[model samples]
Target: MSTYPHFGTDAIHAGQDPDQWSSKAVVPPIVMSATYKQRIPGQPDLYEYSRSDNPTRGVFERCIAALEGAKHGIAAGSGLGATTLLCQLLKSGDHVIAMDDCYGGTYRFFTAIMSKYGVEFDFIDLTDISLMEKTIKPNTKMIWAESLTNPTLKYTDIEAVVKLSKQNKDCIVVVDNTFMTPYFLRPLELGATIVYHSVTKYLNGHSDVVMGAICTNDDELGSKLKYFANACGIVPSPFDCFLANRGMKTLHVRMREHQKNATAVAQFLETSPFVEKVIYPGLPSHPQHELMKKQAKGFSGMVTFYIKGNLQKFFDAVKVFTLAESLGGFESLVEHPWSMTHASIPKEKREAIGVLDTLIRVSVGLEETEDLVADLEQALKASQ
Candidate 1:
């Protein structure tokens, strides 16, 4: 019997046995063929069609499952694609309770697309445990939440949510673990039914590939998702799978740097005269800082703040931080949530959730802490 290794070792070695391949190469080879040769008329060896499965994608899937401490993993073309697969589990009239301050794309999908299909969704502030309990209905099928919400950095209590799921036997808890990744947080161990990620973010660590993944420990749920994945043909290409797997190998190191840099950036912003508020789970001032400590190993690279001066001037003055969309990349980026990420949400709804026009969300990268601090310092002064 083979012994299981540590998280870092599992990342680089799990699902990639050099001896399994004829080439004996250390890296998992990208199997790009659409179909594999069958041994018999209808008897396919391991993989028959690429849509159903690919060797490269299998390795990527297995590696992520191991990282997330899940028995199964399914890859999708994009993050929303993974969520779409989860929604497929619900039939007409199924109700979903989702965090009010969630990713804009997710909000759009739930309200615009899912509603048309007869799936009812309620957007609520999940931090209020009583509110969550009150919102549950007999038809409630899923609770969609983010560990640390985007732009605002609100922390969700995964254990509490899981407890609620246990009380409601019909409900399955699905957590979007993209921000924390498996390095900082593992939702399955905390009793979440499913954990998904946008591989375009930290899991890829580079902004190149767009993909998503679903991880679960339930055999039946995993099988159903796998069936839909193959039937619907939403799986990613072999090359994108290879890239994501390669990026994940260095996730441990990259996440550590991200945490360190973000800590420095958050502290700097808190003291800035041009900054009205700083939001980061790592900071003591954050409302859910204690909950974050209880749930995650470390806080991720995302930070958000409200500017006291002109937001445009601050955006224009920043030299190092690029103004862009998306988070969890190696290069530092800053974005206006009200305009960039949360634009899909209505202005009133956005403001109600504290996503104001003056809000700036920063993805602190692997840059030197002093340099990043200096850059922000200069930018704040210039804006004033």
Candidate 2:
């Protein structure tokens, strides 16, 4: 029997007896078989096929659920697939109350795509706890929010939203815990019924494996989601699941270094003359600094700011910070949401929602803080 360890230790050692495999290897072996043999005709099913379950995937699922304090975890081929499975819970004519400042892809999924399919959704300001109560509707089946929102770097009050959900048992509190990850903020512990993540961003820290996971503490909800995931046939390949699981092993150490570098970078940018406003919870100036301290273990690796000049100049003059999409990896990445990630949203709506052209979002890497700072310093100077 395998003994369980604390969350940090579990990342490295859990769910398996390495000595049972050849050479007594330390890491969990990837069981790539698509089907498992069942001895008896009327016996319980043992992985009838890979589409329903795989040993490698099961190991990763259990590990993630244990780490996040959830009863079940389901892995999907992509982040969108994970969210899509949850969307299956919403029937036609169901109402969804979502954060106004969400990942552009998510906004597009609910507003543009799902609407055509008959699901209705309304955008609400999740930062305001008081307004959230008013936004709830009788038909509202879910309230969606990001722990640390995309591009905006805004912190949603998970505890307050959970309180509101508790008041209304029918409303399922869904949190996108991608930014804070389970390592920092355990949404299930905070009363979130369903937690989702773009495993592409952080959980698969290497950025090599594009995957996502949906977790819940409810057994029935977990079974339903697992059914949807399998029925839809969107499970990740054995190889991808293996890589993602391997990445989880280092998540604890990687997130710490990422937060450390991000904090240093945010501090440097705040003092830079070219910077007008820095939006990082780690900084004292952030509106939700106190709230973040209460909820998150660390402010996380994402940093966004408004550059006080022409957007073109800032965009064109970066030396080291590669202008790219996606985030939460060892390499620092930067992008302009108004053009890149949020292009799906109309120009007027995007600006109104705070996706400004001059707003630069940075995913601080695991590089030396001094080096990252120097790169930014040069970029800002050159932008002028």
Candidate 3:
């Protein structure tokens, strides 16, 4: 057996305790100092500056790395920062293969912005191995995907993609393991060279922090990425790191309840007269249910479905579900990506990827499943 107890134990105990500073305090103290002093005239400081490093941020990095089974982890100001740093690993004229269905922000960043700098990219259905194989070019540098795709909940066969990257020359496999979190899946162990998380979501659990992380087992790449991260100077603040670290402790328990509530909600949607379709990897009807079982320890907390008839009614009828942009919090939220979170994408492109107006994405929370079901039941009926 592994020396550590499973995820639950690691989440609470992986980082250091500041008992030395204050013996009675159970939680790690927020190291708010902007600089750590040099112990002796010529000796190294514990931390020279807040921007480059902080003791609190160090704890966050080590805790996340321990959870992800990575040798190094770096925290960034936001998920976009993490993505931008990863893009630095490639140069002009290099090609990247990305899943057709990913976060709209990611698609926009790579397709619109990165293309200006001469990086080539193609969007293909990652579930189709042959399609991915056909798209690879001589200078392909990376294969990228979100394990459980945003909005649609489509999944990629991570191992298959890793196998392909291994066959290719000088290509690295990267996964945005945000949806499932490290508690449910560790993509690095599944052959991905790197795993990333937008800790703004479930990892922060309470919706208070907005942070991102990049983790890898390769020390050389980690060093290069860290250098660029420091160079960019978009690291998250010390307080945000402290909040995220506190949230991680309850992640294991929170995820389990989130899963249970989500499954209940999905099942209710499956048979509802007002629901046309329900999208969750846990459901047998999902296209990648089998693949999800093979790759993830449990189905995630997000569920997307199409409400019957006009989407406006569904959006208007909900009383408890907040109309919101983000997910993976303790409170449920619903959003229509076509007009809300993903409005930045062109209308033609949004429809092409199945983000129809009727679509509703829910971030199920720890609320009583019955209350949630009843809320949906009433909302759907009232809307009609």
lDDT of 1 by residue, 141-209 (tens): 999999889878888888998898677788999999999999999999899999999999999999999
- lDDT to native, each model: 0.92, 0.86, 0.88
Q: Name model 1 segments beyond 4 Å from true.
A: 1-4
Candidate 2 or 3, higher TM-score?
3
Best by lDDT: 1
Best by TM-score, which number?
1
Assess every candidate by TM-score: 0.98, 0.95, 0.96
Query: Would you give me the overall lDDT of model 2?
Result: 0.86
Evaluated at residue 61, the lDDT of candidate 2 is 89
- Please report how far candidate 2 places residue 373 from its true position, in Å: 0.4
lDDT of 3 by residue, 1-384 (tens): 776667877788776665534564667768788776787775655667788788788888888988998899999999888999899998899999998778888988998889999999988888899999899878999999888888898888899998988777789988999999998899998989999889999998998888899999999999988888888887999899999999999999999999999999999999899898999999999999988888889998999998886667766878778888888899999998888877877888788888888888999999899999998888888777
- Which of 1 and 2 is ahead in lDDT? 1
Compared with the true structure, the alpha-carbon lDDT of candidate 1 equals: 0.92
List the candidate 2 regions with Cα displacement exceeding 4 Å: 1-4, 19-25, 38-45, 310-313
CA lDDT, candidate 1, residue 316: 90
Model 2, residue 291: what's the lDDT?
A: 88
